[model samples]
Target: MSWNPAQYLRFADARLRPALDLLARIGGDTQPRRIVDLGCGTGNVTRLLLERWPAAAIVGVDSDAAMLACAGSTPSAIGWQLADIASWRAGFSPDLLFSNAALHWLPDHDRLLPELVGQLSPDGILAVQMPANFAEPAHRILRQLAGESPWRDALGAVRMGSILPPADYEQLLRPLCHRLDLWETTYWQVLSGADPIIEWMKGTTLVPFLQRLDDSAAGHFLAAYRERLAAVHPAGPDGTTLFPFKRLFFVARR
Candidate 1:
């Protein structure tokens, strides 16, 4: 019930690809002495990062204890640290700072970002992947649908955080890290069954939404979201659903 990633593993392949792609951008023989995985959730991507940089001293940091615990149990040498990235300050010079499907949760990174970048060595690499589907129908429509639902009475001013665009990121990050590569990709996923769009959001955006609600209210929120999705996303004649999802990715070398 507390932000379980295992609940959404049905669409795991599509949801996890961006993280793998971000990790793949690291060049050969560029391994540093220490690495940090910011927003390392459930250790899925963290495991891959360790595989890529096996000998590097890896640190996995996240605010969620449950997620940190999960990461700790994963087969890796990653030192799981439960810390809120916004205020946690450390002096360790990292060789690489990697994150996937996480930075969008921290919009205050305008300040926290440069600070994290400062912890990296001059030759350190930074790779990040984020879900840019916030402004699109997937998120906007959910906000709109929530307003008309029964849970609207209990739901206060629950607004999704604003995620900056690629240009905005490039402007803030390009100067800090050299040879920056940033771009957004829309993945047209062919899923099966109805309400699969909501299923995809379950693994990502729904975390914040669910965290704020009681059990009964959360059920109502999911029910209403499914109703709206069912009406909007029609089932295909081929008996499979089509959900075009979007994600943003960035990689840079300091």
Candidate 2:
């Protein structure tokens, strides 16, 4: 799916919060010499890695050229690579394999999670965070609308894949990891502006479905999706919408 860096970064503060929270879990005593930010879109989080360990070699890997271009614009010592995160392999074992809000895009986590852990160096860390809000109204409304009459033909087979339960992730990584930590957080993301929920979805969840329709169809779909969302996530008296989002996080050591 195509990405718009501008749209994606509209709520930069909210998006950055999760990345920072995940980063804080990486113990200060552990200083990685080589770090790979897998699915490091626009280098927002990769730059944070650089600040924490300026001496460490960091590479931001992403599949989209437009996103990478935006990431490469700023002068920095970090490396930006354009490649698919699912099949992409590191030339050398990295001390830290970090991905934020990216791995959920790929299928078959049962195989993918362990493979990533195997690629780490001895005692290397694999820290990741992904959206666990699939059941939330923002996404549920989209799926409901897509399955309806007019939109059914184009979105019927739209398989965005599934995010396995936390227990399943523990089962997959426990054998390979010497130490593993898993937790979930629900952030009441207060968003402002008309159709704030729709704006937020446009950055990530709305991409795939929108890509399948023409301008007119896409517009109508968004309108319907927006109407449904407003009822479920009504704005507060101050006009800010409280969008409760859940995210899953894990830190594993090889």
Q: Which candidate's TM-score is highest?
A: 2
Give the Cα RMSD of candidate 2: 0.8
Per-candidate TM vs. native?
A: 0.90, 0.98
Per-residue lDDT for 75-169 in model 2, tens only? 99999999998898998999999999999999989988888988999999999999999988787878889999899999977865458999999
- Which residue segments of model 2 deviate by more than 4 Å? none
Error of 1 at 210 (Å): 3.0
Clashes of each: 0, 0
Candidate 2 global TM-score: 0.98
What are the Cα lDDT values of the candidates? 0.76, 0.92
Off by over 4 Å in 1: 148-150
